[model samples]
Target: MHKHSYIFITFLSIIGLLVSSCQQQTAQSDEPQQTATPKDSTEQLVLLLSPDQMKTIDLDTTSLKQTTIRKNMLLMGKVSVSPTHLTSLSSVVGGHIKTLHIIPGQRFSKGQVLATIADMQVIQLQQDYLTAKADWTSVKENFERQQTLNAQQATSDKNLQLARAEFQKLNATVHALEQKLRLLHIDPTTLQADNIRQTIQIYAPFSGTVNKVFVNTGQYVTPTDIICELIDPRGFILQLNTFEKNLPGLQNGQKIAAYTNDNPKAKSTATIINRVSSLDDDGAGIIYATLDQPNPTWVTGTYVNADVAVNNYIVNSLPQRSVVSFENKQYVFVKTGESSFQLHAVDIGESSDGRVEIRNPAQLADMPIVQKGAYDLLMAMKNKPEE
Candidate 1:
């Protein structure tokens, strides 16, 4: 019995020791863990370059300065042919497209034959013109003879009047046919018996490049069908849409920097002609601007970006090179120490004369910035790691 009691006491002591160890482990795990210290503000975004490295890259630094900058309003615009220079081509009479002499982008002069259309109606028109001409000639001769006879008292007045009436009716018919032939671009004088044409020719009314061709050969079209479009490249206009609040600063002859979205760097100059007073359905106002010099490369309806010179004002500004674009956001490298710079986010406003306006200048108050080699620094800070 004592041997059993001793064994029981030993087992109880072992259980108590195991439970105490487990409780200690659980208490340790439940306690709060300490977090690592965050990186210093300068070290987080700074690039520490050696003296030789800075010289090799030609780094430049400049402080902010208060200067007058011409403010520009950036706007989205579209390229279009001036309303006076646009034209739509279609046949006055419906028929199949018989022949096409030009394609889109081909240049043609005024009065040039563009295409030909064929139909039985066109042929019938020529036949009627010829028949009327022949009948009128015969009747005219008979009437002149009757007039002579009446003057000599050899014919009755009633017979002379009857001949005169018949002659006038034929004359009217001939005149009507002549006008119809003109509308068909056919010369009435050229309507000889053997020279009648079954097809009518359509001529270009003005000189321009073919903008579009809608029909193929042998395709049927009606007078309402838009067969083609033409636009003069010399009359390319920049149509800028802006809010009504921006109207006060716009004026005729104001300068504009315009460029296409496809080639934003190739900027072209334009002059505002007018700011329309009427607002569109979206409450957006339109301003028409003509290119300082027309470009044949500009196509109608191409999206464009433009900057309009609104006015001038004093602001804290810096050289344009001091700012860098990253991930679609503008940033500046601010000098935090002798060899350290932190990437700083900035809100930019108007840019002009190689300078950029800082909208929130207070954020960068009295701090030096990477002026000339900002882009190089941005690349280095983003790619290189700290030692």
Candidate 2:
């Protein structure tokens, strides 16, 4: 019985010792856990682990990378030209279309003849110009002879004055006729009574492609008649329609790859030149870009697609999986201590090609980030209390 009593006393002492150890553990639990900052509201979200735990979690660490990111935009619109590129060519004089040297949709260079007119008026003008010149020569000789006689007192002042007046009038008439001959594409210096012809060729004023032909062979054309409608061959532009939401992404000098629905594989490079401030009824804006090489075969008003890479910039970034969303905010895991990681709120920018941009990279510049096991750390942190 004495032995049994001694054994019971020893069992009570052991139970008291266990109770004291439990009290000490409860006191420590009331204090801060892990070696972290003082912001318990956010800093307390930490994973305090050992090397074995890290290996079990399969964590991989990395640093921020300086790389470029851009958002791709697919724009819808059509290829068009400025009003300055379009022109209406008309016959300079009334005549019959003797011969037509051009057809619709044909490209022409400056000074290339489009048609010729058989106008008898051209021959009459040339003949009148030559006759006026001959009359001017006779009047000039008489004026000189009268001036010489007046200096010698052999002619009256009235006679000298009359000769001068006739000379001036005939010279003015000769000048007017010469200009008329030149207007008919006849160089007055190269024209003579022997070389006078009734045919005058109409030439292109600018290098362009004919859009419409208004006259044919044996057709009568007047001064008000349009010969053809022409368009500048190299003045094609892209008029891409974009919404207000996409305005911030577009800017001058950015490049675009434009293509048509019929031939999407054939891409034409273009550069943005203007962003229209005015909006359409649907609040859509215009993005004007000039093509590097204008395709002459492309008809005006052709519907086209523009692929623009916008807001391109170099920034600190990480793999897409390296960052995770929590509580409606973006965050990343940064290694604060050996086997310890803290959740950091990061400001994200543009994302591209499986990579995400970190706008506030300075916050994590000196810290190692959990690159591969970010989602794992997030799960562990969320369930830490439950465990």
Per-model C-alpha lDDT, please? 0.86, 0.86
| Residue 46, candidate 2: C-alpha displacement in angstroms | 20
Candidate 2 colliding pairs: none
Give candidate 2 misplaced runs (Cα > 4 Å): 1-55, 58-69, 146-165, 252-255, 261-267, 312-319, 323-372, 375-387
**Residue-pair clashes per candidate, as listed?**
0, 0
lDDT by residue for model 1 (1-387), tens: 999999999999999999999999999999999999986765656678778767767677887898877777888879988867888899978898899898998989999999999988888988998988988999999999999999999999999999999999989999998998899999998779888887988899877799889988999888899889988777899889898757767889989999987788988899999887699887898899999987666788889999877665677898999999877889899977766778888899788899998878888888888898898888877778656
TM-score of each: 0.58, 0.62
For residues 1-387, write the lDDT of model 2, one tens digit per residue: 999999999999999999999999999999987885564565556778766667788778888999868867799998888777878877667899998888887889999998899887878888889888888999999999999999999999999999999999999999988887777788988887789898999888788788889888998888899888888857788899999867877888989999988899999999999987799889888889988987866877889998888766566899888898999999999898878888899998778898888879888886788888899888878877743
Best by lDDT: 1
Point out the worst 10-residue segment of candidate 1 by lDDT: 38-47
